[model samples]
Every structure is written in structure tokens, then in C-alpha cells.
Target: MTSARRGGRPRSFRSARRVRHRLAADLALLLVAVAFAVPLGWLALASFNEHAGLRTSLPHPFTLGNFQAVLTPDTTYTPMFNSLLLCGSATALTVAAATLAAYPLSRYRSRFNRPFLLTILFATCLPITAIMVPVYGLFVQVNLIDTLWGTALFLATAQLPFAIWLMRNFMDGVPTVLEEAAWTDGASSMQALWRVVLPLMGPGVGVVTVFTFIAMWGNFFVPFMLLLSPDQLPASVSIYTFFGSYGTVVYGQLAAFSVLYSAPVVVLYVAIARRLGGGFALGGAVKG
Candidate 1:
């Protein structure tokens, strides 16, 4: 009886301590989330503020005037449309190219394969600024300046190396026997890839889509240098037009435009989060 009583008290005490520790961790995480969310909340609030209220430290007299200005037919709509088109096209091209390139790299073994994979990995590590001058000159010679197709092509190529590397890693997790079995059943390589491999890679594809879209949408430097016409500009460059070297910054319009620009990415992230859960489950099944 004495031993039982002693052991029971310690176990209960440990349980209580663990509960307290878990509660503390939860609270800490909640605080961190709040801290991160505050800036985004402020930005959202500022987007609704009137132009006169924008300069004030505290938000007062909230109005939709900023959004009205931002969404006005004559404002930055054309650039926003261009940005969406460019990002969508670039992401599609990147995924298609990467999927084709990654399959061979993941499945094959040869001396040349190692060097080729290494080259792609090395390219991913290289800074974009290092090649900008040369790329810009080449684009100029090709007469690709100030065109949406040109920007999409550039972004797709820039994103391709990283996309290939990531897709290769993802493909490695899939079993070769699955493809082999399909081939034994008289499926061609293309058929095996389309039916067996791609369905398993849904998670990687979602990840690639989200990442490529964000990168292409937010890229400012490339568009700024390549696009000379306002109508050809993307949202990233058009947003900067609200502020100039010597002119007064239109903080209200800028904030509103930023909120609008970020909406699509936020929605995509949420959608991808749902797909990611399923992706992990599928990936595990493929691996097992």
C-alpha cells in the first residue's frame, strides 16, 4: 500500500507538470503568431484608410477610398492583369519542363547524369544578379523587351533549375517497380509516367505551382529593367510608380494596391495547404 501510494503521487505530479508545460508552449506559439499577424493586420487596415488618414500613426476614420482609387478602371488594373498572365504562364511552363527533365534524372544512373544533375544544382545556387547583364543584352538582341511572353519565358527559364532539382527529389521517393509493372503490362514510358508517376507527384506539383507563382508574381527587377512601356508593366513594377524619387508617396494607394496584389497569393497558399495534406498521404503510400 505504501509503495502504491508513493508511485501514484509521483505519476500524478508528473502528469500535471507535463500539462503545464504543454499549456506554456501553446501560449508561446499563440503569442508568436499574433506578433507575426500584427503587421499584416496593420497593412490591411491601412488599405481601407483614406488618403488623409494614411500619414497618421494610429488608424482613424477608416474608409474604402483607397480601394476605390486602386480599383478604379484607369488605375493599375492592366498591370495586375499582365502580372497574373505572366505568372500563370511561367508556372505552367516550369512545371511541364521540370516534370519531363526530373523523371530521367531520378531514374537514370550514369557518369553524364551525375555531371548534368550537378550542373543544375550549381545553377540553382548562383545569384540572378550575376547573370542579369548578359541576360538583358541577349533579350535586347532577341527583341524580347517590353513583352509579356518575353517576361514569362525569362521567369520560366530562371525557375527551371530549382524546379528540376526539387521534382527529382520528389520523383526519387516514388518506386521504380510501379513504372516497371506498368511497362510489363504493355504500357509505354510516356503512358507509365502520365498514369503512374504524375498522379503520385501531386504534392510536388502543388508545391512547385505555389512557389513558381509567388516568385514570378513578386519579381520586380526583371520587369523593371526589361519592360519600358507602362501598359506592358506588371503589378510589381506598377506599384513602385506610386512613389517617385522626388514626388510625394501615395501611401494609401500603395497600401491598397499591395493588399489587392497579395490576395491571390494568400488564396493560393490556403488552397495548397489543403492539397499538401493529401500530397503527404499519397507520397507515403508511394514510398511504402
Candidate 2:
């Protein structure tokens, strides 16, 4: 009877402790969800509230004027176009460069590979602000300042190290044996990369593309510092126009623009959502 009581007491105590831990975790997650949800809720509410201030509340009359006001070419269309152009071009360049760079690192063994990868990792950690001064001077020397293509090129360069790192890791998941099979079938290295490895690693490529595009899309400081012309500025920089000359801000319009500004990213994610979840799809490619 004494042994039975002792064992029962310990088991009950452990069960209670586990319940408490689970409750605490649930509470923490709820708090985090609320923290994120509140701002989004505010943004949705304020976008329709014409006289909306910083407060989160329903629109008194629920207006569509804010969206109408920002829908004009100068306010929304042109800047969005610029953002698409710059980010799209830059993303393409970054993905291509990363694929090429990562291929060698993923495939070949070299004494310098680890050191080179470490250097790339270190480069990814660099704050763009730290290098802008020198980069600005170099751009000026090369006559690239205020140029859209120039800005896109720099954005691609800035995103390359991280993209390369991600691509190499993804590339590692693809079996080298697949590439060897291609070689046995009389394919060149490039052909094997294109026809064999890339097809197998579709999800990885999509991930890298989405990541690079999103990073470049939201990057304000780089474009603001490099591109001087107002006409050439992306939506990221142009969004600042919502601020009034004084300390006042058009909150409703700002919220509306913010919603619109975020749309492309949402759309991009949706477009690739299937592929991102597709995994490697390499299950039956090889046989024992």
C-alpha cells in the first residue's frame, strides 16, 4: 500500500507539471498571435477609415476614398511598376548567379571551399548601410548612380551571398548520382545541372527565388541611397510621399498604400505556394 501510494503521487505530479507547461506554451503562443494580429487588424480598419489616426477602430462611415486617392498613377501605379521591374530583374540575376556559384561548391571538393563559403556567410552578415558609402563612391566612379539597371545590379549583388548559401544547401539535397547518371548518358556538366539536378530541386529554386525577391522588394535604404531621381524610385521609397509636409500624416491613405504595397509579395507567395510545399519530388528517381 505504501509503494502504490508513492508511485501514484509521483505520476500525478508529473502529469500536473506537463499540463502546466502545455498551458504556459499555449498562453505564450496566443500572446504572440495577438501581437501580430492587432497591427494587421489596425491596418485593415484604418485603410477604410477616412479620418483614421494612429488608433485602431472601425471607420465611422467606412470610406473607399483612401484607396481611390492612392490609385492614381503618381501615387501607386508608377512606383509599383518600378518596384516590379527592379525587384524582378534583380531577383532573376541573383538566382542565376547563386545557382552558378552554388553548383561548383555543391559538386566539387576543394581545400578552399570551406573558406570561400565562410567568406560568403560573413558577407551575408554585413549591414548594407556599412558598405553604402564605399559602394556609392564606386557607383559614382562607374557612372551607375541613379540608374535603374544599376540599382538592380547592386541589389542582386547584395542578395547574392545569402542566395548562394541557400542554393548550395538546397543543391546538396540533390543526389550527385543523378548527375553521374546523366554523365553516363553522355550529358555535359551543364546539361546535367539543367536537365537532371535543377528539375529535382524545383522546391529549392522556388524557395531561393521567393526569398531573394521578397528581400529586394522591401529593401528601401539601398534604392533610396543609390537612385536619386524621384521618377526612378521604387514603391519602397515612394511610399514616403504619404507623409505630409508638417508632422501630420494621411493615415488612411498610408494604410491603403501599405495594403497595396504588400499585395505583390502575397501574390508571389501564392503563385509559388504549391512548389514550395512540393519537397524535392526525388523519391523514385534512383533504384538500389
Candidate 3:
């Protein structure tokens, strides 16, 4: 018994060392998470406190006036609605166009595909800022400035390179044989793509839609340049209105509006997470 107890000491010490290392790693991660979360937490707390500034504090006596002030017709309502309309349209257009574009890329085996894909990769890496001056000139020539639909269309087009790249990868994981069976049933290529391929790609579709919506929603520059009307602004630009011309600012209201502005993206993320309950087994997607 004495000999066995002594032998167990080394194993116990090793286990203790592992636990200590794991605890340290966990503490480091916790600190990192808190660092990221602190500003967001502060915003939420300040949103509820009428007297709150940019600095975080526990709300001494919480009030909903900041939110109420922002939500009134003169400030947040029009911009928030415009953002929803513009972002939703852009997301729908981008997803539909990307689906069509990805189908051919995923289905065909062509020599041109690699070069075309490389072109798209290069386009994806191109900074939007670099092309904005040219885009603005093009918009002026076409008389598309101040038009919501035009702006949404441009947003969709701007995001196409990335969206098509992501969608094609998702489409490639789906088995070719499924579409072949649909083709055998006398379905046209587009019909097969629509009826067969898209049904199985619900999660992928959700991901693309969420991504496009968030991108458009958060984009300040595109709309800022193209949209001339104050009524057509999105929350991203409208948030700047809280900063007064004389350098005075409405910190509490800004925080409240920020919370509201970020809600849609958060909701979309949660919905997508729930919709994608588990990763699809691409093993079953293709058989060796």
C-alpha cells in the first residue's frame, strides 16, 4: 500500500501541473474576452442612463429617454427604415446573383475557371476605397446618384466577387450526382440548380444573406457618396449626426442608437447559428 501511494505521487504532480497550465490559459482567454466585451457592455449601460457619458459606469438611475429621443421621427426612424430597405434589397440581389454565378463555376470543368477564379480573388482583395472615386464618376454619368435601388444594386455588385467565391465553394461540396438525377428527369440546368442544388444549401444561403446584409448595413462610404438626400441615409451615417458642429456630442443618445443599430446584425447572426445546427457531412455529399 505504501509503495503504491509513493508511485502515484508523480502522476498526481503531472496532473496538477496540467491543471495549473489549463487554468492560466483559461484566465488569459477570459481577460481577452472581457477586454473586447467591455466597450459593448458600457454602451448598453450608458444607453439606459440619461446622464451617462462615453465613460462606462453603473446607471445610477436608469432612464429610457436616450432611446426615446433617438427613436423619434426626426432622427432614427427614417434612417433605420432606409437601412433595412437598402440592406435587404442588396442582400437579396447579391444572393440571387451569386447563386447563378456559382452554379456554372461549380458544375463545369473548364480551363478558364482557374484564371477566372483568380481574377475574382484579385477583385475581392481590391480595396473599395481605391475604386470609390471612379465609381462616383460612373454613378454621375448614369444619373444613379440619390437613387436607393441604384445604390442597393451597386452594393450587391460590389460584393459579388466575395459572395460568388463563397457560394461556389459551398456548391462544390454538394454531390454532382443529385443534379444529374434531376437532369435525367428532363429538368433544365437552371431547373436542376433551383430545385435540387438550392434546397440542400439552406445553411449556405443563410450565411451569404447574413454576410451581405451586415456588410451593406455597416457600410458608410458607399451610401455617403452616392446618396444625396438626408432622408436616404442609413444608421451608419446617421449615427454621426449625434456629433454636433461645435464639437458638443450626445453620448447617451449615441450609445442608445448604436445599440439599436447593431441589433439586426446580432439577430441575423443568432438566426444563422440556429439554422446551421450542425455541419453537413460532405462525405455523404460525395461518395468515393
Best of the candidates, TM-score: 3
Per-structure clash totals for the candidates: 0, 0, 0
Clashing residue pairs, candidate 1? none
Q: Candidate 3, which segments miss by more than 4 Å at Cα?
A: 1-9, 245-247, 274-288
Task: Compute the lDDT for candidate 3.
Answer: 0.84
Candidate 1 TM-score over all chains jointly: 0.81
> Each prediction's Cα RMSD?
5.4, 6.2, 5.8
lDDT of 3 by residue, 229-279 (tens): 878888888777888574878888889899989998888878777554586
Error of 1 at 186 (Å): 3.5
Please provide, for model 2 over 1-288, each residue's C-alpha lDDT reduced to its tens digit, 9 standing for 90 to 100.
999877777777889999999999999999999999999999999999989989999997799999999999998999999999999999999999999899889999999899999998777877777888898999999999999999999999988888888899899988898789889999988898899989999988988899789878888889988998888989999988777465788999999999999988888878877765656443211111
Ranking by TM-score: 3, 2, 1
lDDT, candidate 1, 1-288, per-residue tens: 999877777777889999999999999999999999877776777777665434434446778888888796446688888888888898999999999998888887877888998898777767775677888899899999778889788889888888887788888988898899998999988888899999988887778778678777878777877788877788888887787574887677778889888888888878777656654532211100
Q: Considering only N, C-alpha and C atoms within 3 Å, which residue pairs clash in candidate 3?
A: none
Taking all chains together, the TM-score of candidate 2 against the true structure is 0.87
Off by over 4 Å in 2: 1-6, 10-17, 244-248, 267-288
